[model samples]
Target: MLVAVVLAVAATVGVVLFTRVATRPEPAARPTAPPPATAKVVRTDLVDRVEVDGTPGYGAATPLSGRKQGTLTWLPEPGKVVDRGQPLYAVDAVAVPLLIGSTPLYREIRADVPAGPDVRVLQENLVALGYAEAGPPDGKFDAGTGRALRKWQKAAGLPQSGVLAQGDALVLPAAVRVDRVTAQLGAAAEGELMEVTGTERLVTAELEKSRRDYAPAGAAVEVRLPDRRTAAGTVRSVATASAEEGETKLVVTVAFADPAAAPESGQVVVVLTGARRDQVLAVPVRALVALAEGGYAVEVLRDGGRSLVPVEPGMFASGLVEVTGPGLVEGAEVVVAS
Candidate 1:
């Protein structure tokens, strides 16, 4: 009877333990997130580019020379930064004879009576020619210099105003733009010449033939000057035919957009020939999954859950494709990996 009671109690205890163990709850599985999107591509219809090289050149050049056969009275070529409308060349071709003290430009500086043999000859010749009879054969300009001005004006068909006029710019044989003048009031000479450069112009560049096709019509360009400053320009002209220097061919001449910054002759520069776009979106090639519906799909992370985002793939590529899809903006976080 005692053995039976022990066996029954042991059985009841085992049942209670087994029932408690079975009632305990199990741990839940953690959820995984969706992947991100990354691709890169450029729209073919948008911007195009071309590259080239060139040297700066002036748009126009005017040459200046003496109008009369008088001596080259002034030597002012080497160190003059002439301003527009400033005088460059001067000659003392007076006729009727000037007073001893008449040099308009050099009133401060004491001038020797005879500047040199050539000047002396010029003075004598001017007096004999009736350009000026005022100054001594001392070869200096004086008050009588106006006679030389009148004579030159008459021969060149210019106004006898004596004050140099604009049309007189053409009378110079050497060819240049006239910037300024210091005519002796009474001095006389047969004719005189002076010239100045224009305020605006362009520099040309030579490019390689291989880069020619990319050289677009109306493409934007930059002209680099000797001072390391860059001026903007356009691709003005591109040659259809090519020139060969040994085995290499060269394309010729790219005109500048801005003439204000061009360098002096023989100045070399690089031509930047393209435009840039901003705020473009890009992604890696593997990030894209082609959906069965023929559209593109990317895994998006939203509300702590991963979901399939159907995207319209327009500009796609091998490595990275340019993406434009719904709810896609800069800084919008997306899951790139599963």
Candidate 2:
């Protein structure tokens, strides 16, 4: 009986051990996540910029009124570029030419008139037009001046009077492109006659007075055209305009580096670079990883492995962040969240 009991106890112990082994749950599979995406550490230049709206066209237009007192017999076609010594319009069948000067022809320019700045301007223009052979303009209407005036008059199909009348020629600062003909052909030539603008195409933009430093004169900028092309440009001028709604504004004019590349008319983007970094280690901004230690770090990938390296971030521009750190070479790769 004792031997049978011992054998029974042994068999029960074996059965219990087997049941415990079978009932034990398999080791839970540890949760895992795929590796993060990555990008490269590129060496590139960065330019911090401010973009603003700009309008492209021939600069501002100024009214070209008729200074001659006569019946308007002829007018230049719109879009005609009137240069110095060229006939701007005809007055009663007499051509009134264009002259480059600041002073208008308010009185007769002849030998008998008092010497003045207007005479000097006329003499200078005469010399420029190759109609006069004289020294620098002395402001005196001498015999040479009379000869030059007569020569110009003859060339313009007018009688050689040797005297410049009160309404002889029109004076403007420079050559102008006729924008619009405001006067009719048969109307009296007295008031507003036409509108003219500079021949060069320029981009005009309005900037808030507080942000004037963003686009100072002579600063370089990039112009993004309506067709998605870019062109180099320079800030030609900046002027303060009258305050509107109690906020002052600035008028900024930009000229194309190559005028041929400028479009005739369209709204453009003016990119003003405020700062630049050259030949620096850069990466996509997304590659920047915030650290729990109060600084930034980048997960650098090397030799099929990745390690987080602390980096000092610099200027951020064009979706790139300038980074600097130990062992951060140009060709190295960095982790970026997908």
Candidate 3:
């Protein structure tokens, strides 16, 4: 009976404890709030002026024999640095058969001779090839003109022909040469015969017309040569029309402002494009949270608080993108702590 009384008392105590534990109230869960606006980051970009590849070309053109493409003569014997007015070719005076009638300039051919613009073009091209001797190519073959022609012919080993043959060559424009046969030995040439060139810039590059706008004038540009040498030059000229290749091109001509040596012609090179930003709004791309509702939003922090605002994105250059949307006014102290 005593043991039974003790066991009963223990059982009553256990029951009282269990009831007390079960009656205690449970701790409440902490509430969760929406993420603050300032927590999110929006990327931004700005419109910028950029540069494209362009090449320095002869501001002028030099004419060559149009007779088909004769057996590629001497190809400007490699390594000859002929100077301005330097003789490049000397054709034998033998009466080469002319498919096209040969008429001396004295009669000057009764055909509609180019008077003003056409002559201007000739003079300009002649000056470019070092044949016109730097003065305004007056289109009149005066003594100075004869002197230049004779100088070139003499150098070319042609007879001291004071007479400027209608198809005689003036200079070799390009530095490369290839073997090509274009006319019948006894046939004739109805086009330009002699070719010539102008001064050499440290490097040369060609630009496609599509990228013309990007290659602004006075752009800081550089050219990498095969020897790993980089020559610097400014944009001297930009061709306004599409080249004969049928591709619109902006020939950005650059000459080494301070070149150790003139860049060799006919070398392949890689051109680089660069960009800069002036004054514009930029935003983080990731900070742009697309709320399922509509429009885009960015987080902003003020006095330890956050706010959300929508924005309209604009042109992007490099890493930054331009934006002008809700909460994005010019000079509106936006934070880009990152």
Task: Please name the candidate that would achieve the greatest TM-score relative to the true structure.
Answer: 2
- The predicted structure with the larger lDDT, 1 or 3, is 3
- lDDT against the true structure, per candidate, is 0.48, 0.88, 0.49
How close to the true structure is residue 13 of candidate 3, measured as C-alpha lDDT? Answer: 97
Tens-digit per-residue lDDT, 125-204, candidate 2: 98998875533798998888888888877887987998887678888988899999999998888889999998899998
What TM-score fits each model? 0.32, 0.71, 0.49
lDDT of 3 by residue, 115-201 (tens): 333333334444565675624755554556556655655654555666533444332323422122233333344444343344454
> Model 2: which residue pairs collide?
none
Q: What is residue 165's positional error in candidate 2, in angstroms?
A: 4.1
Count steric clashes of candidate 2.
Answer: 0
Return the candidate ranking by lDDT, descending: 2, 3, 1
Model 1 lDDT per residue over 1-338, tens place: 99999999999999999998999787787878434453323333323344345655433334343343344344345324443223344444222211111222221111333254334443444465456553466644444544665565576444565443222222212223234443333334334333344334455555565666556666666666666777776665555444565545544445566555566665656554443434456555565677786888766656777667666654443344566777665554455543
